[model samples]
Target: MYRVIQFSTGNVGREALRMIIARPDLELVGVHAASPAKIGRDAAELCGLGEPTGITATDDLDALVALGADCVVFTAQAETRPDEALAQMCAFLRAGTDVVATSFVWLVNPRSADAWLLDPLREACEEGGSSLYVNGIDPGYSGDTLALAALSLAGSADRVVIQEVFDYADYDDGEFTGVQFGFGLPADAEPALMATPGIVASIWGGSVHLLAEAMGITLDSVSDRWETWVTPTPIDCVMTKVEANCVAAVRFAAEGFRDGRAVIVVEHVNRLTPAAAPDWAYPPEGRDGVHRVLVEGHPGIEINSHVGGGEISETFAGVVSTAARVVNAIAAVRAADPGILGVVDLPAGYAGRVMS
Candidate 1:
């Protein structure tokens, strides 16, 4: 069994912890908590697993790093603190621990990442002889990996578009839904997170670059476009309330151009409620969400993924899938060559085996 230490217990991190405890091939060695309130708490409690694992959450970084575990599942939020997260990952890597993370989405395709960011990670890998992989559902598997896999059926391709259409009303993250995506704010409020310059490129642009690389084509340039819709009436959801004229829906596209034409595109259509953007794309009947990849070619192909659970909402199921994507890649990452690794570098079929 591979000894594993979990970092943070946020939405994704808690799911990662549940996965670590459930996997027979993985052993939980430690858990790291950023907030003092979480410190000294049992790992099982943090994950809501209803049983004790005897592993307590600690705020001490040095001790967790010194544990010398095989892999550290780093699911800490990176958008708010990219530099700090990068430094923490580097510290763990330099200590000779392989890492699989959902943070640093740009590392989905390391070549597309900034030189400064990539250089230090490369150096850290070389120094510790440990490998690091960054990935998630949209930016990781559903967008890049799955999209690339579907392209194999195409005889000829003109355009590739990967889209994630979600209803955020059921999602519980207030800060993410309201502040980041401008869900509860007015439509005209100073550009929300999705409208920030280069933010879309920084988050989803790597997927565009990854697709272009898979297709063996060079992109002339990358471009982005965004649009927002407001709730015409007051609406309430499990997470937050949206007053009339508040930002309720957003659609954005990040595209990679070849020969002055868009060949690769990553688009997102997120709404607070299903009715908020009735005219926008909707998932299959009875399904809450979908991830789709459309390849415009001689034999155009479209792949749609509908991930839902009986007990949890589709939004939470998406988060669990994101955690599974990274957690399942742990073993492959540990055995891989030392350096910053991308999804393309690892072999196919890292998804964990189902236990009967």
Candidate 2:
């Protein structure tokens, strides 16, 4: 069994903890919690599992590194703290622990990553002979893998568009909804860092590059565009109130051009409430969320993924899938060559066992 340590117990991290305990091939060695209330609690209790695993949460970074576990599942939030997240992952990698993370989305394709951001992690891997992989559902399976798979069925492809459409009303992350995406701000206000110049390229650009590489197509340039929609009426959600004329929805697109035309594109339509942006593309059958991959080709193909159903909200389902993508890749990452690894570097069937 591979000894594993989880970095946090947030949305994604909690699911990681549950999967770790449920998998017979994985053993929980330690867990780290940023909140004082979570520290010293049993791992199982923290994850809401009935049984106790005797592994208590700790805030001691040194103790976690000293565990010398086989791998560390680092799912801590990196959008607001990229530097700190990088340092933490590097420290664990230098301590000889392979890492599978959902924090740094750019690492999905390290070769396309910023040199300054990726070089240190590469050095850490060399120093400790450990490997690192970064992935999540959007920039992960839905962006690169699924897009590429769909393109394979095309006889001749001209453009590829991958889109994520979701209603974030039930997503309880106030900071993310209010600050990061500018969801509750005035419609005319500047967008969050994600929609700013070069940010989307830095995050989702790797997916574009990955698809181009798989298709043997060269991109001349990449660009981004974003727009916001305002609610005409007041809307209520778990996070905050969306008063009239406030930012209610955001639509952003990042495109890779080939010979002056877009050949690869990643687009997001995120709305705070369903009523806020009723005209945006939604899932078939009135589903709340969907990830769609469209390949414009001789035999054009469109693949849609609608994950959550019943009581499961789209946000929670996304969180769980993100964690599963990282956890499922743990074994393959550990067995990979020491360095920054990408989806293309690993085998096709690295996803862990299926659960009914």
Candidate 3:
């Protein structure tokens, strides 16, 4: 059995652990926690499974590697220091272990990060005969997978556009709430936190290029814009305004082009809508706003799909299910030559199932 070492105890890590537990072929080997509170606890407890799995969270990097794990699923946030995270991935690869992660943006856009870190990783994987890949719900499926799904519907096209409109007003996580919809800090405060180079440009920039390459378009240049404003009043919700730390509305949008020709338009908003009565006319966008993917191309065809657009429970369930699919694709992770890797990299014969 392949031993899977989960590197974080965060929400995404927990979700991945659940999938691993349900899959019969895989074994949960160890849990590595960066926090002291979680250290020495059963991996099952970290995942809220109510029981320990003999595996305990550890902070000793070398000890974690000594466990003879076949692969590691990394979800720990390196925050402003992504290089530290990259170093860990390099170490894992060099130690003869494969890795699947969603930490640094370089996992999606390796060209931007210091090649000093990535080059060694590529070399390590080659020498160690191990595979490495990074994917998640947002950058993993929503942007990449969704884009490829739309392209599958097209024959010949000069350009394809994918748009995802999600209601940030409903997101309640503190880490996300602070930057929901691109709102980094108060409008009047010091330079917005989300306006920094990394948050605004680096985050979605990779997705734009990933989509462009999937369609075989060589992008000449890329530009983006962000807007953040407060709601008329406070929104009281479980995760949206409350947990998301969204006091008002936050919106982030970007447009990509090839040689002055528009190719893709993508936008994300936190708390973009207001509360309304149940029977109120919710309009075409739906009550939770709209999560849609629109493809405009030959003969003017548009395909739009949304999250919570039909069934609210199914929409949330889809996120969890897609996360599981991302974990299952761990075995397919491969090193690339300094460019964006998109859904096209996933082979047509790929079944999108758990790796044995």
Candidate 4:
């Protein structure tokens, strides 16, 4: 069993802790949290593990790393401040602990990180002999791995498209519901303000680009836009201007090409509220989370995947699944090149266990 140290005590950390408890291949070695309320708690208790495992939380960074953990799973707020987070991650890697993080900073572009961030971390990992990686549900899996796996069904294809739609009302995060989707905003608010600049692109762009590269298709052009409107009331008990309750619709499309020939196209949508269309699935009703993968091949094939959604447990599970994949990818940490690494570099059918 791999001894793992988890960073932070937020939703992601808690979710990961739950998976470790059930998986016999991994063990929870320690937990580091900034919250004083969580600092002294057992890792298992945080996830309702039924009994304490004696692995209490700690605020002491040095002491936490000294536990001789095989790896560290970081789900901290570095996503809001990626540069600093990347540097800190490098420290853990250099200390001989393989690093697995879902931080947004490292997810952006491994090369874009500051010299101070990558230099020491790379050296440390090289000397200590370890590896590091960053990932998340949206950019990491639902958007990338699933899409790539579907593409393999066709021997050859001229184009591929992956689409995802999420109901905003089902989401309970204050920041996500209020700002990101413009759910509770006034009816008179401008529609342009509903979609935050770079936020939507940051989430899906990486996946689209990665898939294109893996397919050997050069991306000719990419475009993204957001649409928001006030709903008459709220459909399906949702309340928003974009829809009856408060729904914001955002769509992204990317056209790929090879030598000036269009080879692929990808389009996706993030719906925050309910829609008037009878076909549009709304959360709390029919299938809330649904994904459709369509391949335009010699014979044309399509696969429909229906995923259920409900409660905080489901939300935590989706987010935690991404972290779990990163942890399972830890065995190959040593083979990972210095600097930031993404899911694309990850081996296919990775077994979600040891990296090797």
Output the better candidate (1/3) by lDDT: 1
Angstrom error at residue 86, model 1: 1.4
| Top model number, TM-score | 1
TM-score of each: 0.97, 0.96, 0.82, 0.79
**Candidate 2 lDDT by residue in tens digits, 152-236:** 8999888999999988888888776567788878777666777779888878898888888877888999888888889989888
**Candidate 3 segments whose C-alpha is farther than 4 A from its true place:** 109-117, 180-185, 239-247, 272-291, 304-322, 334-342, 349-356
Number of colliding residue pairs in each model: 0, 0, 13, 16
Question: For model 4, how big is the CA root-mean-square deviation?
Answer: 4.5
Ordered from best to worst TM-score, the candidate numbers read 1, 2, 3, 4
Per-residue CA lDDT of model 1 for 212-330, tens digit only, reads 87888899989888888888899898768888988788888888988888889999998887888889988778777889999999798999887775788899998998999899898
- Could you give candidate 3's per-residue lDDT for residues 1-356 as a string of tens digits? 56888888776777778767657667888778888999998878888787567888888888877886788887777555667887777778777788877766445645434566567777877766776766665555656676667767777566655555444434445465345333333445554566554465456677777777667878776677666554444555545343233335555655677778767766665443454222222225334544456666754555554444454543354445445655676555533322223345656434445544
Candidate 4 lDDT by residue in tens digits, 227-309? 55445565442323344434445454444545675455445455544453334433334555555667787657676554434
Candidate 1: residue 140 Cα off by (Å):
1.0
Give all candidates' CA lDDT scores: 0.88, 0.88, 0.61, 0.62
Better candidate number, 2 or 4, judged by TM-score: 2
RMSD of each: 1.2, 1.4, 4.5, 4.5
